[model samples]
Target: MTTPREHVRNAAGFALVWVAAKAAHRVRFRTMGSVPRTGPVILVANHLTMTDPLAVARVAIGHRRFPHFLAMQEVFGWPGVGALARATGQIPVARGSASAADALESASERLDQGQLVALYPEGRLTTEPDQMPGPARTGAARLALRHPEAPVIPVGTWGPKQGNGHIWHRHTACLSVGAPVDLSPWAGRSDEAAAREVTDAIMAAIRAEIAQAKQMWHAR
Candidate 1:
């Protein structure tokens, strides 16, 4: 169930991202319907820029779901943004500290509550010149195992990184969300080896979608 404040915050966040996206680029979302409308879901995506959460959140809202992301603790300490993040129930990741574990635990609880939990398995935005997602962190895999009932949907985002904050220059942000990664193959196993397999499969799905998005972008 959602509260009035949650609805208000989500609307505000969507509006903020929409306005920003309009100034920065023309945004397009594809295959967003693939995500389950109601239930526990783990949204795994490639991180391209700081604006990724906004873009992903926008897509989630469009598909009738609210995203609870694992964001940096420092971001939750930001002025107005921090308050909004808290209001919307975003988890804060305190890198290099026990808070990170707390964040993961919190995320698991959110999943148990049947909410959508968005995570960038790469852990951080990529610095690669090509802007591809870096290696996947083990947290995502472990999380998936802990809640095997929740499907991990791989979403690929391209173009949001191009505009930065240059309002005068318009770019295009293309997001493509694919079907959930199949985990049935490792159903009974929650061991490290199984987690590693699941992790590779999750990353592979993300990479496939990212590659497809890039091709689509370049073809345009």
Candidate 2:
């Protein structure tokens, strides 16, 4: 059950996100597929820039689901930002540390609580010259395999790259939400090989969504 304090926090968090997102870019969100109103959800998206999380959050908020992101541990060290992150339940990932796996466990716990967990399976921003999504890091796949009942939704975003050099300039960002991927074929498989296959399937779905999002970006 959500407490009154939690509801207040969520409202404040969503308001902050809206202000920051609108101040940075003119975002156009399109939901090509449905996001389950209630349940555990794994939202996987392609990472383009550091601002990508804001875009994804905008989409999730539109669907009435407040996303808890798995962000780098360094972000949790910032003064006010860190405090807010902790309060809003964002998972911190300590990459290259022994405690790295702990983030996944925390994510699993959130899933068990029926919360929406969002992650960039690529692990980092895409380095592709064309800005296409890179390889998956298996974390998202592992979560999916661990919780087979949760739907893995693919989200595509474009236009944030245009604001990289001109942070003050507001550019148009286009985001498209895709349907949940069918992980039935790899259900109950936690092996590395299975994880890689599942990640590949999930990335393919994300790429398809990106392709559509790109078209929308250029047309606007």
**Model 2, CA-based lDDT:** 0.88
lDDT of 2 at 162: 30
- Runs with alpha carbons beyond 4 Å of true place in candidate 2: 162-164
Tens digit per residue, CA lDDT, model 2, 1-220? 9899988998888888777767767888778657998999999999887776877888888898899999999889988778877877899999989999999999999999999999999888888888898667999999999999899999888888732565667777788899899999987789999999999999999998888889899899
Query: What tens digits encode model 1's per-residue C-alpha lDDT throughout 88-150?
Result: 789999988866888889999999999999999888877778888767778888999999899
Off by over 4 Å in 1: 1-25, 162-170
Task: Name the candidate that leads on lDDT.
Answer: 2
lDDT of each: 0.82, 0.88
| Cand. 2 TM to true fold | 0.94
Clashes of each: 0, 0
